[model samples]
Target chain A: MTQTFEIAVIGATGTVGETLVQILEELAFPVGTLYLLAGSNSAGASVPFRGKNVRVREVDEFDFSKAQLAFFAAGPAVTLGFAPRATAAGCAVIDLSGALPAEQAPPVVPEANAHVLEGLQKPFQVSSPSPSATNLAVVLAPLRGLVDIQRVSVTANLAVSALGREAVSELARQTAELLNVRPLEPAFFDRQMAFNLLAQVGKPDAKGHTDLEKRLIHELRAVLDTPALKVSATCVQAPVFFGDSLTVSLQLAAPVDLAAVNRALEAAPGIELVEEGDYPTAVGDAVGQDVVYAGRIRAGVDDPAELNMWLTSDNVRKGAALNAVQLAQLLIKRLV
Target chain B: MTQTFEIAVIGATGTVGETLVQILEELAFPVGTLYLLAGSNSAGASVPFRGKNVRVREVDEFDFSKAQLAFFAAGPAVTLGFAPRATAAGCAVIDLSGALPAEQAPPVVPEANAHVLEGLQKPFQVSSPSPSATNLAVVLAPLRGLVDIQRVSVTANLAVSALGREAVSELARQTAELLNVRPLEPAFFDRQMAFNLLAQVGKPDAKGHTDLEKRLIHELRAVLDTPALKVSATCVQAPVFFGDSLTVSLQLAAPVDLAAVNRALEAAPGIELVEEGDYPTAVGDAVGQDVVYAGRIRAGVDDPAELNMWLTSDNVRKGAALNAVQLAQLLIKRLV
Candidate 1:
């Protein structure tokens, strides 16, 4: 008989949380009972699942110990306050937000570091990964092990949905307004994010790098577990909705050819290669896809030591929901 | 007093031609008489100029020698056949297309190469510079002299306006169709050109690089006279209607810091630096502007020998119209 576990989805009304619930049902994650919890804003909202409408309950009133596992997709503030509570109630937590404290609980991209998660014994354990970093790290992990990466330069064309649902709707609304010859009113972003690319994504920290850029640096290092890897990234807020596209240039310690890199990517799991005519695009090919679609593979013009590629992934799926679900599944397999 | 010249604008009904005429009026180029010539399709169309409508005349019937200067804004096929005829008829030609014969007539960015136009002696001479290459070359010329640029990798996010007027309207129409939940019809471009990015702009050659990429390589070499400079580019057809944005990463022979890069950019002509808390964007800053806005200056993480920058320019203005007008002005001064 297949044993089932009780599960709870915090912030059930958000996009990532909804996607997490869907993936659980789609993957048939052996759920005995499901509780969808939210704050007053989305408390009464009804989410359909398994041929039934489950109304959202207040997260404050819901008993955390009732569910053996909890997936937190709330914002940083909510996750900060409630994640510890859920853990104290003896629930293993898989957090989609990167706002976890530096408490050494282990930030994980399951594909990259699944070895560490095989024999965990701690009850109520919690871990998180940066959404943007999760996608990049999964793609880089296999390559990092194969090639001695000397330096890496990344230009990430991130979609508005990377921000949240509001930003995606804002793009559609602003684009409509502009198309009708009406003035665009900016909200949720500093400048017009529709039909325009913004160089800055988040607020700047002390080093003149945007907070998003700095986060990518820290999180990529943590996910790849390479403390000294040299990486630089330019985060651009592109005028798309659901996916993040990255142009990655890697400088290796030794020279390599197209065949070797192709071998590396093909061997790596959770990545789909698009090699033929018309490379993958965010709007056209990457939406609703679990695997990162990588294409436009070319060697550096200057030397054989470097390689360049284009990567597109649905940031909502692989970047957040699927990674979280995979980590949750790993947590289950670790139970002794 | 300013000396007047008789000028004809080929392809007078197109976007580049309309912009060129407006710029001539805005910059007050000394014109004795203007002839707006188009093909059979736009023969009777009237373009507004100097507060009145100027009817488009048939290019086949018009005498090329009647005007001393001919600006070939038409497609390459027309220019290929007519440019030599205009030159043979003693009309000086400023061909914007890069398909000119391989003989070394100065391919100029006036700011970087005004010295080459000082003593021209060919009576029916023609010169050309690719629009995309002109923007990139103007920015790189200053840095090429300062730093030993080992290699450059560029990601150009080009707008539909670069393709011409029909592509612009296609974006509008496709966006409306997509917003209304209707299927998109790809007419001018191979794929849907609304809210999507295409990796290939021109036809791909044998080496998998697009024709546009080949042009950038050839023209940048001709503009900077750096035959050995290593350069590679990926041209993306972005959803924006105007202004092209570029992300350029340069690997130098020696280490440099933020202050040095800032100093070089500050000293460069025809450049505007956007610093701290704000950066230049294609939409908010570049449209209708004559200056190339360069900002988001960052150095490499692991090595100080590398630098990255964000560049945006009005492709119609500095890329085509203003550069052509400036060259015409240069030719006028060279007449003595």
Candidate 2:
């Protein structure tokens, strides 16, 4: 028998949240009913789900008691406040934000670590991976099968506007002004977002790592189940509007061939291998796509232990919304 | 009595060649006489130099008989054929291509390795440093005084249109056409040079490194005089029309602070530091400028040895024409 699930989409108006609604419609997921939840400011607005307008209710007032699943795209504060309540209501929470209390939550990439969510008796919480995690996970999938990862270093040229819708608008407006067209005043970002790249992403942690970078390293380890792995990241914001690109260098525990690496990626789901001479997938190419586009894979000429590749993904979709929806779909498949 | 130099500029109507004429005029070089040489197709054209319309002479017909210095900005083939003839004519040959026979040529970056060219009893043959070397030499000047180098990994997102005027025009036309503005057929590059980033630059070496990447690696070693140092580069073409941006990750020999890096770069000539907040220098900012703009400098939280920085420069000026002219100025001051 076909199963239908009731779902709550928290932060329904956000970039990721909006994408979640769109993907649900596109995939034709068996949705019996949908709830749209957001903060006080966004409450009362409506987003379309299954061809019907669903009004967004404040998170505090939302009834999670009847929902079988909840997708949290809101910030940590909202996720922290509402996720436990929803879980208490017996709803599985798929969180896109990294703010979930780690002890109770498990970070997941559906393809890489979907099994981690299969046996949870209690209402389980799964997080949508960060842009970096979304990038590294797909590339790592091929490598993990071949050799153990000794160390991984990634430098990200993250697009500044990937922060949110406001950031994206701010960049578009500022770019117009910078080129003597029209002024887009700075409000969403702390500084000028036009024609410039920023090095800072998430708030700085006590140890100086950006919160996003730290989370990516942590999430990578957690999802891969390699506790002893060494991971370091230097994330910088680029002027692009949508996609995030990373130059990843990995040191493996054993030697691996480039052809084998390509084979692994070819077999992986939701990954499109971009070959040399193909355009390096940019923000525009990834803006509405769910798949991770990867290219420029090269084994180091001097060292077999070293491998390099470029990973590009739509920060809003694969990095957040689609992953959340995918997790929800997996939960439904595993549960009654 | 002042010694006068008769100079001939091969490829005189091209971007670098035009800039060379302008710079020579601006620097007031002692030009006893000047000859402009171009391909047979451009033989009848005239380019303005020092307020005079200098008729372009066929490169094949040009006699270097009276010239004391010859600047070859033509392609490798022309340099391979004509540079030797100029040298045989008792002229000091400054080749931009570096494809000149190794036995007769020594690579030179005026600021970093000009001393190598001093007091040559035989007419010296020097080739311009690669764009990457020209950039690294200027930025490394400050770093050398601050920290010892261990290794560097660089990914060059080079704009191939930086190759020449024809490529630039082709790219602009193609971009416009791609956006449905007008038809701009491909001419200079092998494919449509619009809205795309190509990965190959120059010819690929047997091991698959691009000619420019190979030259940069070798030229950097020669200019820095660091034979044992390790370097790896991935060069890719971007849709940009002018500047080149390098995302550099360095493993320093000693621990260094980000502040020290900022201060060092600030004090360094030909480099503008854009470190604070989200202010990253863009290709537009560096276009038509001489300075290499360094920004978004950050330290790796997990690994102190790893530091990330972004560098952008006008490939035509600082990367090519301006640098060659600077070498000429240095030669005039120290040798002539």
Candidate 3:
């Protein structure tokens, strides 16, 4: 049975939010009515949905009384301010931001922990894992089912497009200008973004973990339900436009068969298995894709307990927008 | 007193070869004469050495007898055919390919194992450590002095520029064309090189290790002198034009102070300690630089036995050319 939903997409003009509208329509989500909410700057701007243009209204002026679900694609500050108001008005909030604390709000990846969202009576918030974690989880899910994950080490090459629309534009403009031989300047980023890779993302905590790195550590533990699992991550920004790639190493408690592990990944949901010879999945290849493309799975030659793999995904889509919409679908199906 | 000698730079038109010429002039390596040798296509190409233009001569036409030290920056195939002839003719061959089997050659990283190059009876072939190994060695050198390394897990984000000039150009051209831009094609690589990261280098061996990865493991073991120590690595290409970055997690046999480790890194040779907040060393910043920029050195919160760090360097410089030149300098000093 298909039920119609009057959905309000908060932060509708942003990268992930824009993607949310497109993906929701593409997947044929039962949207009886669509409300596009954005900041004052983007208010009244129209976006295409289901082959029609929907006008974006200012969030401050929008009424959520009729919204069956409010998808918060806005930043933490806006989500914090408006989420409670939307929830109190009898609208279920599915937030993509990590504004709420992890323990109180259930962080979810549809493929990993969608079941947690099934019994929510109060307003539900869905926090998509950071890009690195999202890619890691997709690759690690099948491996964990086959091996006891004792340790995980990852190095991420993130794209500027993951920083949202402005940064993406900045990278593109700067790259074009630089190629045409112009003076390069750093704008959206603290340093020059074109033709370079930056290793740090987000502010570093006192414990020495960058915000992105910390999120990956905490979120992975929460999603995998392995609080004591040891993880080490290094996040780097590359010169690509939209997709992010990660090289991951896992230390298993027991020996795992490479063939079985490979087969499991191939059969998993939202995953595309690339053969051994195919790897370093490029940003252009993953830009519009929803599935996590993975390849170069190999067992450590000298160490039988270790396995290596590479994963790539469109950060704005599967890592954020698609993931949020998938969570909402799970909610609608009562599967989460 | 500095010894001046006529030097021949084989593969003079290649990436590392260009850097070799630049660094020799920058470091004031006493060059009485410079001979630029390359393939027939590059025969008329000119490279600047010591403030003068030196036209490239075909490898077959170069007079080896006039040169005292020949820097072989060419690929393995060229070195295999030419190096023996040069060495047999009484020229000191500094081979960068590192393809000579262990039984016949000695791998050298001046900072880690320079002693092997001293007092050579025959023409000594000084090989730079593979990019992955060289990077790992730079970070590990400081730590090894403080703790016993149990094992290491590394994921290298190797830039396409590391493949040499042709690959870099091809990547740039393909990337532009893929975006609906005009043809920027440069025929230096096997595939469309733009906006893509290729994970394969040096081809894969029978046992599934890339020739580059396998060589890195073997060279690292040999340089560290821990034949039994376990090391695992995954090398991936990033879209950046220069600079290779690595995320490393090392297991120590005994706990060590993170502060003390950072201090050691600051004092280490060929290493520049990047500030904690400064990471993701961009290609522009790392390019034309000789130092291995090390940053984000931290201990894993979940595991005290492990340490994580980000290391970046210009692959053409520190990873290949500069290291080769440094090896020659060390040999002259009798420190090798």
Candidate 4:
């Protein structure tokens, strides 16, 4: 007999949430019944599932006990408000927001730290890290044995789409306004977002580090299970719309063999290592892709012990939705 | 009496060359006569100088001995072919192209290595470092006194105009095609460069490092006078039409004081330090500006021995043309 579980997806109208629903359909997960829920403002929207329109209902009115699993894909406040209700109703929760503390819902990227799930109890809670951290974890997990990484410095060139649907539209609007030679009246972003790069993404704390950068550093360390690791991160808001491009440099304790690094990446799951001399770009290769594309892999120009590479991935799909769904697949096996 | 020199501008029709001509006018450089020279293809084109349109002539037919100083802003091949001729004619040379060897034309960033000019002989020759290196050198030169740096990692987000005027037009055309939903047939770039980031700028060598990256590392080391310093550089071509943004991380020998770092940056010439919280961008702050904008200065999240900063500058002016002009200003004092 085939056993299937009922599922609920919160924030179904969001960019990542919509992609999550689509990926659930594409992966053909054993979903007995799918419930799409959103806030009151978006309650009437309908999302397609199994070639049929599944109307979104208000989460305030939906009975959480009816669904065996719930995915929180909204902002931190929304997750903070509704996540407890779903967990109290004996439903497992997978949070895309970083609202829950690591000890309460340990961040998980299956490729890097699936073992963190073995000790979970019923009504399980887990977190999918930020796009930058998840993408890095997937690519770095395979290299754990090849090199002794002492420090990591990453510059994450983020896409505007990660902000939301509004940001995507704003980039288009700004680009159009510039191309047409119209005076730009900035709206979504505070300044010019077309053909420009913003050094900081969100507002920084008193320490001069944005929330996104702090989250990446903390989440990457946690997922890689190297809590004492030193990570220097900078998150820049690029003019890009859909994918993230990251340049990473690592300090190794000993000289690393380039050929061995290539072989490891080639054999790793959830990663596509580009061939030598050719590199990957967000639009040409990584958009809508399931795996993180790693390229330009080489040691430092003069220092043999240093490693540098470029990584690009579909932020909404592989970085967020797909990672959460992969966690769900693993969580279901132990769901009692 | 105001001393004036006869100046020859090679590649006068190029983006940098045209900008150099304008900057010379803005700075009110003493000039007896301005001679514009370009390749045979670009000859007959005119560039405006000091409220007059000066016609460009072919470099092959021009007499180098007629000018007291020559500025080479063309490609390396062009400089390699004509720089020797200019020097042989006893004309002091300032080359923007990285063609001449360091021993002959040492790389110079006026803010970092103005002292290198004091050692020069007659018919002085100097090379302006690449944009990434010049930008980094200007920002880091002020910090050499505050911190004992161990290693540096940089991710340079370069603008399209750095390649030339044709690359700028290609970016605009490709962007319009993408926005209009038309099928894109990439002409200037090998792939879709609109709303995308190319991981590598130029062709990489057998060791997987591109010429641009190597040039940045080499030129930066030379200008900083830190030959043993290890630098990891990744040059990514961005969608921006002008201005270059760089994210730099430095490993220090000991804990760094954030206040001292800020004070040092504030006092440095050729650099504008933004307010602590408010950051700078390439287009909003750096484009068409004479000074490099430095912002988001902070120590590492957990490691006090690490320093991180963001820098953006006008690649054509402050990075290349203005730096070259500044070198010429210094070199002419010793020209006999």
Candidate 5:
């Protein structure tokens, strides 16, 4: 007999939160009771779960102690404040935001860093990797053991949904406006994003790197556990809606055979390898899937020791929601 | 007083050719007589030159001997057949196609390699640098003397206009359709380009590298005269209508100071340097401009020897039409 757990999903009406509810049912997670909670504006809304409408409760009024496991897909401010309260109330929390848990729980990509959760149980606060870092970690995890990775250079093409549902709606409206030759005003992004590529994703830090780029590097180092890993990232906001794409170049410590690398990527978990003659596209291949779809893999022509490839995944599904769901499943298994 | 020359513009009805005609007038080129020629299909159509409409003549029916200078902005096959015929008929040819000249004339980016055109006269044949190579050559030419560039890695984000007018129209149509929830069918590009980035540009060679990538490597070496300069290029088609963007990384033989690199880029001809805080964007800064706008220049975190930057330019203006006009001006100067 399976033991069912009471679950709470914060920000349940948002993009990732709604997906998380659907993914829970799709994955057939045994749930005794499901509670959907959102901000006051979205509190009265109804969201579907398991073919039934679940009424969203106001997060401010909900008690954290009611649920055994709580998934926080809320924004940073909400996660920073309420996550602590939820954890103190004896509920396990899986943060999808790239925030450090109050308990300083290790950031985990279950397929990449499952060893970290070997003995963890309920009442522990942990993090599911950010959609950006999760995809990169999944691809780089297998290669770390195959050969020492000296350095990595990533050019991530992020979609609008990485911002939020407002960004998606803005893109749609702005695109329509532009098509009808109406003037555009940027609201969500600081620049025009419709039918255009914006090199700046998040705001820049003191060193001139955007927050998104810096986060990718910091998280990859901790998740990969290569304390001195050299990472260079350039994040661009592509004119896409659902998927995140990356052009990654890896400098290996030793020269690895191309055929061997190909074999390893093909067999790697949480990734699907599309070799030459079939490149992986964002909308066509990655938007609905949980796997990291990768292609255009090659040994760098300038240096055989370097490997380059294109990686894409559903930033909403694999990057955030599915990654969180997968982590929750891993945590649930160790609950007993 | 400016001396005038008889000019023939092949492919007069096409996108770049139209831009070429407008730019020639905008820059006040000395044109005694302008002959507009296209395929048989566009024979009776009229194109505007100097506020006057000139009837488009069938390319086959026009006599190449009548014009003193011929600008072949036509497709490669048309250029291959007609350019040689025009050259044989005692007319000088300026090719924008970037193919090796049929008469083995040197390819030139006038701003960077104008010295190559020193004593060349009328009836001589030459090729203009492709828009890709022109901007890169202009930026790299000045730096070659200051620092020895050992290797270059470029990720070019190209616009639909790079493909042609049909592509621009398709992007416009597809974007409008997508906004209205209408179905889409790919025409010019094999993938959906409404709000997506395509990893593939040109057809792949036997080694899985696309022809566009190989051409960038070859032309950069030839134009910069860095014979052994190693280049790894990945060309991605972005979903914009008019501008081109590139993320470039350069490995130098010796470490160079950041201040010196900034000075060289700023002083370089036909390029405007944007500093760290303010970066140049493709759509915002590059369209309708002759300058290659570049910014985000920085050193690699792992190795300061590696320099990276963002480059953008008007693909039609600087990338094609203006580069050709500049070359023709150089050729005309030599003739006088």
Candidate 6:
């Protein structure tokens, strides 16, 4: 007889959470019972799964012992609040938030660092890195030995959907108002978001680095297992709604071989390398895709040691929900 | 007596050309006869100068000798076709198009290298660098002495207006169609550009570097007079109507002092350095502005030798038209 485990999805009504539930259904991950949980404000909302509406219950009142595994798809505070309880009940926790310390819950991108999972013990805890880090890791993992990467500089054009459904709706409203020639009153965003790009994604610290930017640097280094790698990151909030577009430039220790790099990228899993002379964009190519689309690959104009690329992927899907689900798939094997 | 020279603006009906004419009036540049010339399609159009509308004549028929100076704001082909005639007619040439070789028409950002203008002979020809190059030259000129720069990486978020009026109108139309739930049929742009960012601004060469990207690298090196400087440039076509946003990361030879860097930027001309907490956006802060708006300045997360910054400016006004006009302001002295 086949056996299946019951699972709980925290923050199930949120954008990434709902997508997580949908991905679970799409991937058919041997689910027996699904519990959708959210905070008090969203507890009554219903998320659809397998053509049925699953009403969300409050995370505060739920008992963690009922489920063998739980996915925390909410903010850092929510993960910090309920993660311990779930782990204490012997539930394996997969955190989508960058809340737990790297020592406690090592960030894992299955395509890059799947072997890290073998190191964890019972009542396992693993973290899915931030959207930018996850997408970059998937693309960069293949080039680990192909080039001696010395420094990496990335400019991430993030979508509004990364913020939440409210930010997504705000973009639509702002665009409509501006198109109709109505006076724009910015709400969800501090400034006009339609037809514009916001340089800073979040509040910067004293050193003028936003949490998102620092997160990309830290998580990328952790997943790549290169602690001393020099990374420069800029997370800009684009007018886009769904996917994240990244412009990446890498400084290598020696002149690179373009033919070998292309061959490696083509053979790598979890990435779709578009043919040369054609590039991918977030809305058209990456919005509903499962793999990260990479194109415009070339060495620098004059410096052969420099390499540049354009990458796009679904931030909520491949970057977050799908990554968490992939980790869960690996965990299910050892759970029983 | 105040002496004014006759000036002709080729491609006067273009976005940059129109703005150049307007700046000539606003900055009170000495203009004797302002002859507006464009291609046959735009020849019959009229553009406002001072209080009256000036009729644009056909460039093919306009006599180059009729003006002492000519501003070639059209495409490189048009500049290549008519600039030699203007020079032969003893007309001082200011080419906004990157058609002429750097040796013949040296790229100049007045704030960075106005000294290049002093070496010119009669019927002088000077090229106004690309918007991205011009903006970067202005910001980097002040930092030349402050840091020992080794390499530069840039991701330029360009507006559709850089492609002129048709591209701008397409963005508006694509946006409205998407907002109204109507089927989108992309016209000027090859893809859905409403809420999407096109990774490539123009067709890339065999090496995957577009002409615009190469122009930026070449022009920046010339303007800063750093011929061997290493630069990695990625120019993305954003959905914005105006203003270009650039994310820059510089690798320095040694550790940087943040306080000293801030002081240099604060004292720099042609730039507005926003405070630490508040940042600038293209639509909210840079559109229709003369100076580049810079914010989110910091070092790398762990590397002190790396400096990153965000910059936004009116691509047509401050980047092209105003810079050209500023050059002409200095040229009027030598013209007479």
Candidate 1 - CAPRI tier? acceptable
- Writing each residue's lDDT as its tens digit, candidate 3 over B1-336 gives 766877899999998899899999988987778899998888999998766899999998876878878888888898898888777777778887876775466667777777677645556566677766776776676566688888788877778777777677776667667655685554665554565555666566554568777777888888777788777887776667888888878888766588898889988898888777656474645676878888888888667778888888888888888888887787555422
lDDT of 2 at A203: 63
Ranking by DockQ: 6, 4, 3, 5, 1, 2
List the global CA lDDT of all models: 0.79, 0.74, 0.78, 0.93, 0.82, 0.94
TM-score of each: 0.91, 0.87, 0.93, 0.99, 0.93, 0.99
TM-score of every candidate's chain A: 0.95, 0.94, 0.95, 0.99, 0.96, 0.99
Write model 4 residue lDDT over B243-277, tens digit each, in one string. 99999999999999989999999999999999989
- Candidate 4 residues lying further than 4 Å off, grouped into runs, are none
Q: Which lDDT tens digits does candidate 6 get at residues B131-217?
A: 999999999999999998899999999999999999999999999999899999999999999999998988999999999999999
lDDT of 4: 0.93
Error of 6 at A142 (Å): 0.8
Compute the lDDT of residue B6 as modeled in candidate 5: 92
Q: Per-residue CA lDDT of candidate 2, range A237-334, in tens? A: 65566777777777666665878877888788878887544535554456678788777676665666677777878777887778888888888876
Candidate 2 residue lDDT tens string, B1-336: 777678899989888888888878877878888899989987888888789899989989878877878889888899988988887887778888869644467677776777777744457678787677788777876787777787667777676545887776676566546445465567777664443335457655444457787677777777777766667676766555667777777777767777888888898788888745433444446777878888657665566666767788887778888888777666655445
As for candidate 2, its clashing pairs are none
The most accurate candidate by lDDT is 6
What residue pairs are clashing in model 1?
none
How does model 5 score on DockQ? 0.50
Local lDDT at A83 for model 6? 98
- Residue-wise lDDT of candidate 5 within A16-120, one digit each (tens)? 999999999999998889999988999999999888899999988989999989999988777887888888899998887767642376788877887877756
- Each prediction's total of clashing residue pairs, residues at least 3 apart in sequence or on different chains, is 0, 0, 8, 0, 1, 0
Candidate 6 positional error at A24, Å: 0.6
Q: Per-prediction DockQ, in order?
A: 0.47, 0.23, 0.55, 0.92, 0.50, 0.93
